[model samples]
Target: METFLKLFENPSVLKFTKLGLWILLIVLIIGFLRKLLKKRIEDTSVRYKAQKGVEIIGYFLIILMIFMAITLDDIKDYTIIIGLFTAGITFTLQELILSIAGSFYIFFVRVYKPGDRIEINNIKGDVIDIDSIYTTLMEMGEWVSSDNYSGRIVKISNAFVFKGPIKNYSMDFPFVWDELNILVTYDSDITLAKDLILAEANELLSEYSQKSKTKWQEMVERYYIENATIEPTIAVNLTDNWIALNLRYITDYKLRRDTRNKLFSNIEKTIRSTKGKVTLASTTLQLLKIPELEVQLKNKL
Candidate 1:
């Protein structure tokens, strides 16, 4: 008890204790503010962003307080030491520094926000969080097909923004052009198949097609973009086996698989109604030669 009392009596110890108290107070205040923010903000993305901003500010304040407490007497005398230390830290944490810079770049350049589906480094997912070091994604399309979630969370380094391309699915326009293909026999009525595909796509995706057209027009006006076919259109590719009728149309990214199922089902019904006019194609196996096999007698006999 005497030793503890003496330690507290020392001026340097007292100063450090005061600084520690101040740091604790700051931490508590920031925590309270974050709790208040959580209650006030409803949007997950916005709430997270605000919380991060508050945390950064709190860290800066804590660091500033520490710096001021240590350098109260002679900050100029420590300048060279500080410079050298900063340089060493910069060299040691080069990747970390780059990631921080990339975080700033992502925020300022409006690269993709939380809730946006993005693909970077060939990794496709929906952005869930953006922190100082990493961008967290709810992964999709690994073992799954057509933008379906794969039940995996992926954390990518923010520094990757400098190294690769990022494809955002819902930044300016919230629609994507998707293609569905059906193979029809070479002898089938190619024109009727095309017409049937176009008819089904137009009927099913008419709302999305019209909305995407307006969005594309807005994009054209805002950016230097060319006019595109936003409506449901059909293109035919002649293959060795069959003619591929490709139905291209705009759709909400989230509703792609559902839309495709509806379109395919509807088109199959429509084609079936056409009887033998537009027959679906399949691979035909033509045997050039047959191998002979001999039967063996049973051992039990």
Candidate 2:
């Protein structure tokens, strides 16, 4: 008991003890406020922002307490030394610092938001969450077709925004131009096939064109972009074995797969209803002639 009392009597020990108590009290108060804020905030995004701010402030306070404890006198004399130390630490953690900066950029500049589909450095996905150091993605189109999710969640460094291109599918213009190619045999009625495809695409995608036109107009007004035709179009290409009719149309980014499926089903039904008028093309190999063996019999008579 005497030794414990003597230790407290020392000025250095007493100062440290007071500093420790203050740190503990600050941490408890900050934690309590964070919990209260989380409960009061209804929106998850707002809650997340509030909690992050509290965490950053808490860290700063703890760091300040440590500095105060270490250097109680002549803080001005140590300014240069602290600045050099900070520079070294910043250099070591440059990537981390950049990621934090990226998070702020994402928040303020609106590079992307949760639920927006984006592709960065060939990694495409829907944004799941934007964190301080990482951006979470529900991955798409690795082994799957037509922007469908591949059942994988990927976390990429937020600093990737500074590294490569960022392609957003559903930003200002939420519609994408997709194509479906139908090949018909040479003997089939090419004109009739083209008419049927164009008719089907127009009927199925008429509503999409209307919706895209409004969104596209908004995009034009917001950015320096030209107005484009959002209607369905048909282009014909003559291949070696068949005539390919390409049906191009605008569709919502999320509904690409479903729209394609419906369009294909309708086109199939329409073509099949034509009986033998529109014959689907298939690859065929024809053997013109087997190599003729010229056997000149040498008669040694």
Candidate 3:
């Protein structure tokens, strides 16, 4: 232990030892603070911000300690050299710098945060985490349909925000307008079909209709947009084979698939209970013209 102490007594060795000790102290302090943060902060978003702020402060302190360990004369002599080295590093790591800048832009602009369902550059997901370089996502809507998670975690570079438009599903308005079409034979009761479909929609989507109006009013006030109907509506169109009743309604962004399933099931049951008054339409081919067929058989000898 005496030999080790003697080795650290050298001026250069002593300076580095102090720097290392300070860095270790910072790490321990940061760890303790993080534990306290976890215990004290219950709100997830607030906790995340505080934890990240502490981490950045810890890094800054470590860098400050390293700079202080260097002699003043060395800094004076190598100032220009350090400037040139930094310039080179900046050029080499320009993409990383842009990514950090993009992260700052995201935070400042409130582009999207953790828990926002967003789509950008053809990738769609619910954001799980956002860091300086990347936005982590619980990926959705690739092979799976209707906003279902694909069981993949995607890490997209934050710099991609600068590249394209982003669609946010759960931001100001957490509800979306979805349309479901029901086709009935031309001879079926179009009025009853529309009434049944509209009734089912009203039943399934009443909550969204009531809640989304206030949220949409906020959006209209914030953006340049006109008032949109939130209540369930039915529009009928006549086609060659069938009469189509398009049922449009508002629903929570995440509940679209389940809501649709329930609405369709209810509508089908209602329509079937009508007992052929509302017959669902299917494409049928009619044999308008048939080619002449000739058959010749030889008599058995």
- Each candidate structure's TM-score, on Cα atoms with residue i matched to residue i, is 0.80, 0.77, 0.78
What is the C-alpha lDDT profile of model 2 across 1-301, one tens digit per residue?
9999999997767877988998898889888988999889999888877876775677568779978776875557658877897799899999998887787778778898888999987899999888779999999988888678899999999999989889999988888999998888888998898888888888888898998999999989999988888888888899888888888899988999899999999998898899999988878898788888898979798
**What does candidate 1's lDDT look like per residue over 71-128, in tens digits?**
7855586688778988998899999989887887898798988899999989999999
Candidate 2 has an lDDT of 0.86
The numbered model that scores best in TM-score is 1
List candidate 1 segments past 4 Å from native: 1-28, 39-46, 59-76, 287-301
Candidate number of the best lDDT: 1
Candidate lDDT values, in order: 0.88, 0.86, 0.87
Window of ten residues with lowest summed lDDT in model 2:
69-78
lDDT, candidate 1, residue 26?
A: 89
- Writing each residue's lDDT as its tens digit, candidate 3 over 102-172 gives 88788779899889999987899999988878999999988987779999999999899999999999999
Model 1 lDDT, residue 286, Cα: 86
Q: Name the TM-score of candidate 3.
A: 0.78
Deviation (Å) of 14 in candidate 2: 12
How do these models rank on TM-score, best leading? 1, 3, 2
How many steric overlaps does candidate 3 have? 0
Lowest lDDT sum, 10 consecutive residues, model 3, at: 69-78
